[model samples]
Target: MISSEDHARLSQAIREAEDLTTGEIVVVVSEQASSYRSFPVLWALLAALVVPWPLIAITTLGPARIFLIQLLVALFLSIFLSFPSRRHALVPRFIKRARARETARREFLGRGLTRTRERTGVLIYVALAEHHAEIMADTGIADRVGPEVWRGIVDELTDRIREGRLTDGLVAAVRRTGAILAEHAPPRFDDVDELPNKVFVL
Candidate 1:
């Protein structure tokens, strides 16, 4: 969902940030982590089950009529929400964030962020649909930086995302993260760049 220019901004942020630290920083943006294809169907079924109750209590409808109405409503809702455009709303926020976290974890490993010689790799992962972000520091960095620090960065980035300025948010967070790394994981003279700076669209 990010433009090339925006992506470049993130890459630049990474490069600038990493220049002062041995830590490797990677940024990843994803529309969402999981398909959640079953949510629409489940919600439709739950809604249908609820529909018959109101009808039975308020409409004086016969059992057969209620059943028919319930079935039709369920079918219509399921069909309508099955479209990708509308499906995401059916999934809950907590589930989306959880999946995004899981996705980020996988990406951290997949991108070799966890493989940094000093274990100072840091991953910045964003899920557009979930409006969620995570900052994962590898062992060496995590041992130095507390979870509260990363939580603050994630919170700030999420606020920017809600305001539709994801680029700005990322840049700010990247700089902040870079500063943190510069303090705790300052670059070694012999350090070699181990990761790409460009943001990967997942």
Candidate 2:
């Protein structure tokens, strides 16, 4: 479980690692509830049924014909509402945004900022009325370092970046953290680990 203390630490780390104005960094870690993209899909399916049912029933001669028409309508609705291919001439901006968002989530997870393998995208609720800015990560980060340590790292990074000392601070923090981890838990020859040597930068 993540705590407020850890959130504060991570916020500081992020500040130190990136150059930003004061009050730019805000970290809030909390439990996440269900995400419902399916809701829109269901609504679309229902709307398709309602819109076509009357027309099909009135125009079709037999029950079988009506059923087929309904089926076709459902299929068309699903395809229409679903993400269209880039080949479509209508709206390219939406496609680009979706592609960028996917890439960002993948990158974030690859860096070890999030724990879940499920691609839920960057938004994670940390507490009541608070959220963390996960848009920076393309792939979610794993919880290799304990929450406390991770939070501390974020806090330090955030502070340094806000102070315009991002480059030096991040290098020092990564080295320091690596040394501490090495001293405490040196890897064995048989271990099959593939962790990155460098810390992720924003």
| Whole-model Cα lDDT of every candidate shown, in order | 0.91, 0.40
lDDT (tens digit, per residue) of candidate 1 on 29-139: 898788888988998999998998778778888999999999999999999999876898878778887899899999999999888999999999998877778999999
Candidate 2 Cα outliers beyond 4 Å, as residue runs: 1-105, 108-145, 190-202
Q: How does model 2 fare in lDDT?
A: 0.40
What tens-digit string does per-residue lDDT give for candidate 2 at 79-177? 565543312322244443454445445554554445422221122112111122122321322223345654666466556655655454444454444
Q: Count the backbone clashes (under 3 Å) in each candidate.
A: 0, 48
- Indicate which candidate wins on lDDT: 1
The TM-score measured for candidate 1 stands at 0.86
